[model samples]
Target: MATTSCDVAIVGAGLGGCFLAMLLRRRGQNVVVIEQGPSIPSAGADFLKPPGLRVLARHGLADLVGRHGLRRDHIRYYHDGDPIQDCRFPDGGFLIRPYRELVELIYTCCAMEGVEFWFGAEIGDIAVGGGGVEELTLADGRRLRAGVVVGADGTRSL
Candidate 1:
C-alpha cells in the first residue's frame, strides 16, 4: 500500500540499529529505521563504558547524554558474591542510562537529522543479488529500496 526508499535501510530499532542509524544520518545519508514493534526497545545493556562514551563524545553527544545519565568513575567487581576488585576510570567516567533512554536520546538527535522511522513495520523478505541486498518487502506489501541495507535486528536473529 505504500513505498519508500532511502540511502540506508536498517532493520530493527534496538540499540545498535538506532545508534548506527544516527551515525549514518550524521554522515549525510538518508536513513530509514524499520522496527517491528510499535516503539523502541525498552531493555538492554545499561552501561556505557569508556570506549562507548568516547564514541558519543566524538559525535558531540557527550554532554547531551551525560546530562541525563549517571556518571560513575568506579566499578566494583564481584565474583561468587564477593567484591574482589574495584576499577577506576582514569579519564572521563562511564554513563549509566537505561538502554531505552539512551536509544531514545539518539533517536531524538536522528530526528533532527531527518532520519525516517517506520514503527510496527515487519519485514517480509529481502531481495538480494550481486552479493548485496537490493530491496526490502514488508509484510503489508510496502516496498523499500536502499543503496545499503543493514540487518541490525537483535541479539539473536536471522
Candidate 2:
C-alpha cells in the first residue's frame, strides 16, 4: 500500500472532471483524477450548447472540439406525430459530437497539462474529518490525501 497527496483529488474521469483537472493544472494546482472505468467515459451529453461552447472557447479548446463536429442551429420537438416546438440556437448553434470523442479530446488536453489520472481505480473508503473529506482509500490499498476532493463522478457518484 502506498500513500500520496495532491492539491486536488477529482473522483471522476468524465468530461467535467477532466476539464476541471486541466484548468486547475494550468493554474499550477496539483491534480489527480480517479476513474472506476478503464478509460475516459464513453457516454455523455452529445450536444455542446452555446454557453458551453463559449466556456471552451475561453479555454482555447473550441477549435479543437469543433474541428470535426457537426453543427446545428435549430431543434424541433414533436409529440404524438404532431409538431410541438421549434428551438433555434444562436451564435453558430451547437456542436454535435460523440460523447466518447468529446471526452477523449479533453482527456488528451489534461494529459498534456500533466494532470494525473488513475484508471480503474475504485474508492474503497473515504475518511472524513471536520466536515470534509480527509482521505481516500482505493480498493487496491492506495491512499490519496488532497486539500480538496471533488465528486464529479456523475449522477451515481459515491
User: Which candidate should be chosen as best, given TM-score against the real structure?
Assistant: 2
- What are the lDDT scores of the predictions, listed in order? 0.88, 0.95
TM-score of every candidate relative to the true structure: 0.90, 0.96
The best candidate by lDDT is 2
lDDT of 2 by residue, 54-158 (tens): 999999999999999999999899999999999999879999999899999999999988999999999999999988999999999999999999999978788
Q: After superposition, how far is residue 52 of candidate 2 from its true place, in Å?
A: 0.4
List pairs with backbone clashes in candidate 1: none
Off by over 4 Å in 2: none
What's model 1's lDDT at 9?
Answer: 92
